[model samples]
Target: MTDKPHHPLTIDGEPRAFFGRRSGKRLHKGQERLFQDLLPTIEIAYPETTLEP
Candidate 1:
């Protein structure tokens, strides 16, 4: 037998995981809004930091 998850975690898949479909599809109205509205609000500001270790 293979190790498989029992009950699916109904959580939003964040702060722990992000469960999503492997395929891609056109976004619906609500999903579109998430990209147009919510996404812009969380833009990452990059800095001139060096990656030297």
Candidate 2:
């Protein structure tokens, strides 16, 4: 398991606990290509509103 940083929206800003294989396998070549090709098209800018702590 890896020690991943928690996104602020996560439970009280704690690292998530995982009990199973997080990702059983790495992305295949075609999947990798598609991710590279498509991710930017669906992305959004971060919200400008102030976040509650």
Model 1 / residue 20 / CA error / Å: 19
The lowest-lDDT stretch of 10 consecutive residues in candidate 1 is: 1-10
**Per-residue accuracy of model 1 over 1-53 as CA lDDT, tens digit each:** 21435434446632333468646989999999999999989967667896566
State the lDDT at 16 in candidate 1.
37
What ranges in model 2 sit over 4 Å off?
1-17, 44-53
Q: Could you estimate the TM-score for every candidate?
A: 0.36, 0.36
Question: Candidate 2: lDDT over CA atoms?
Answer: 0.66
Provide the lDDT at 2 for model 2: 32
- Which regions in candidate 1 have their CA more than 4 angstroms from the true location? 1-24
